[model samples]
Target: MPADKKPNSRTAMQPDDASRILVTAIEVGDIETIVALYEPDAILFSKSGRAMQGAEAIRQDNLGLIALKPTFTIDFITATVSADGQLATNRMKADLAWTDKEGKEKRGSVDTLEVLRRQADGSWRYVIDDPYGSMRANLERR
Candidate 1:
């Protein structure tokens, strides 16, 4: 999947550029632009125990969250990229407060363990996008 697809206008991301893409998607909620950074037929094995592939699946999965946290943003104070800058594993604490489908006001936070992989294009994408370590992170925390 080496993206030798002409230099053109797209900036060649420096390996761990996935963070920028991820952050951008969260901030803007634009699935098309975000998925463009990844392989056309990539599969995401999410930590939520959801396995999704292609643009539509990923888009819908993210859209489902918006009803809860309409505007998602990461507050990563100590997110570090790998030595080669090809991967990044972060421990981020996120907070979201919203009314659920049942009209219940709830505040929640998750300690995340996110993983990113460098694609053949030298740009990084979330191959295993584990934004939340597990439900346990939310359940165990008081």
Candidate 2:
């Protein structure tokens, strides 16, 4: 995609469900809530550079996220849906902090791309999401 190409990819039914789930999944750190917005076999590509497949994978990550951070805020700069209304992607800048095993808290801002898949029920879920958008570059070889 060229800079002047103006990449606007979104569907008519993309915004409502995709925006809500994207915000809730990160803002509240609720995995189950996020999962409810997804298809049972959806795949997740996280910015942390991990590929979590299915509800079970999402559940495990969500549980750890809650326990580790408990609080995190996500801000969306822009988001768009696929033309078919089956996919939506968002650009989020996150502000978060977590306690390490050594009892120290680590915090920072990371650039990421969140990809959501709209289910058959008009709901949205993460199909291949990422916390750090650049992680995909690293995943290419794997």
Q: In model 2, what lDDT does residue 60 have? A: 76
Predicted candidate 2 versus true structure: per-residue lDDT over 1-142, tens digit per residue:
1212211222224534454454445455555455665567766665545677888887777676656653346554567878977777877676677778899987866556667776665646655656667445765666
Stretches of candidate 2 above 4 Å error? 1-29, 46-48, 135-142
Top candidate on TM-score is 2
Best by lDDT: 2
Worst 10 residues of 2 by lDDT: 1-10
Worst 10 residues of 1 by lDDT: 1-10
Would you estimate the TM-scores of all the predictions? 0.59, 0.65
The CA lDDT of each predicted structure is 0.55, 0.59
